[model samples]
Target: MTALDTEVAQSVGDIRESYLAQVGRRRLYSGLALLIFVVLMVSGFNIADERNAGGFWEGLHQIGDYPGEVLTEAWQKRADLPGLISEFFPALVETVNIAAVSTIIGAVGGLILSLLGTRGLAKWPRLIPLFRRVSDILRAVPEIVIALVLIFILGGGPVPAMIAIALHTAGALAKMFSEVAENADLKPVQGLASTGATWTQRMMLGVLPQVAPNYVSYTLLRFEINIRASAILGFVGAGGLGYELRNAMAWGPGRFDEAAAIFILLFSTIVFFDQVSSRYRNRLTEGQAQ
Candidate 1:
């Protein structure tokens, strides 16, 4: 080959080798990361199993035992199932109400927090970080922790659960609402501002109109989540279907029928809400896209 051709060929070969080496290094790093993740997962599972009240292997086969007993008892007392459900219907209504009220209050609080935290939308730009930190702290606290503490002070009732769920919902929704607000078209806000509109007016007329669909969708999903949370809080003396379930469970074998009724009610309610929320969310998103 000519000298020039030979030089070019050498350069090309070196480039190809370097590229291959880089690719090999990337693959090696990726494999190492995957290995570490697997190790951590296995170790975490083993640790959790060790600390559990029943060993994983020992309880694995018996996982169906409780459900089986419940089902058998429920079948034997099938005639009483409707009566049991009716008796606990009030508790179910309380759970629903708690979720509903909490969602409404939380959504409103979150709307304010999101507006205050978002850049370009904040009524007080200097307080954005403070608002964000407050939201983070709220989201970090568990609903059960808040519920139990409130119950101690207020006595057992649905109010504590409602407030606990609302606080958590507000914090959780604030981050999401702020993200949506950040992407909102600023033209409307600017136009409104030129008309001597206040921050509240601009937000309500300009920003909220644009983000309402997504906000409502998120609120509905949160409502579904709050229902389950309220029920759980009830188990800790907050008072709801969970309280009824706890009472039934404490009665042992004879009360399996009652437990089964509560389980069916809870499961049915969850599924119903999930389906309704999913349908509405789909419609909202589709409408927004249009």
Candidate 2:
């Protein structure tokens, strides 16, 4: 064969070899991943078995006793609906209150933070990093940890939980609000600024309108998360269904029915709200189309 033909054949062989190498690499990665997963499953089950000393299997054998009542058992038999709605619902209201109040507080705090975060607003330059860092620190802490600490100082109940959720919410909300402020149509803000509009006025007239729907959507979304958070806080004596859930589980099988019942109710309510929120979201975006 000519030198050109030899070179062409060599190039084809190189391409084939490269393709095989890539296929080999992918297969090797897949095999390693499967091995790691199998090891994890085996180890996890062994650890679980050691801890339970076969108690888990024993409990499963007795599943017939805890038949249906999902809500009570899930929340744990810590509360029945009559007792729950009458006594704990108020605490539930308190949780919702905390979420609402915190959201508002965070919204306001975030507005100020947003101003500092935005380059145009943070014209002073030195304040930008300061504001960003402050929010970073605030956002870095998890809400649950914050609540745990606050419970130590403030002495349990919804107050500490509220403070914790609020702090975290503010950090997150402010960061989002600031980012939104930064990215809004600058033309509207510029137009307002030219008309001697105050910063608040410009935000209200220009920025807010542009971002209101998104803000509302996020708020409702957080409310859903807060419901779950509040439920968990109950486990720590924050006073809600979660407290009952822990109690039921602590009491063992007999209480499982009640805990399951509460879960059914709690989850059902959350599902209802989610449906409502989804409808509202769809309605809001109706004009925009999918």
lDDT of 1 at 131: 100
The parts of candidate 1 lying over 4 Å away from their true place are: none
Cα TM-score of candidate 1: 0.97
Error of 1 at 109 (Å): 0.2
Clashes of each: 0, 24
lDDT for model 1 = 0.95
Instruction: Give the TM-scores of the predictions, in the order they appear.
Output: 0.97, 0.74
User: Largest TM-score belongs to which candidate?
Assistant: 1
TM-score: model 2 vs. ground truth? 0.74
**In candidate 2, what are the lDDT values of residues 100-184, reduced to their tens digit?**
6766676667667767777776545678888888888777888789888888888877777777776777677768777766777
lDDT of 1 by residue, 1-290 (tens): 69989999999999999999999999999999999999999999999998999999999999999999999999999999999999999999999999999999999999999999999999999999999999999899999999989988999999999999999999999999999999999999999999999988999999999999999999999999999998998898889899999999999899999999999999999999999999999999999899
Off by over 4 Å in 2: 1-6, 37-41, 44-88, 118-125, 175-183, 243-264, 285-290
In order, the Cα lDDT scores of the candidates are 0.95, 0.73
- Predicted model with the maximum lDDT: 1
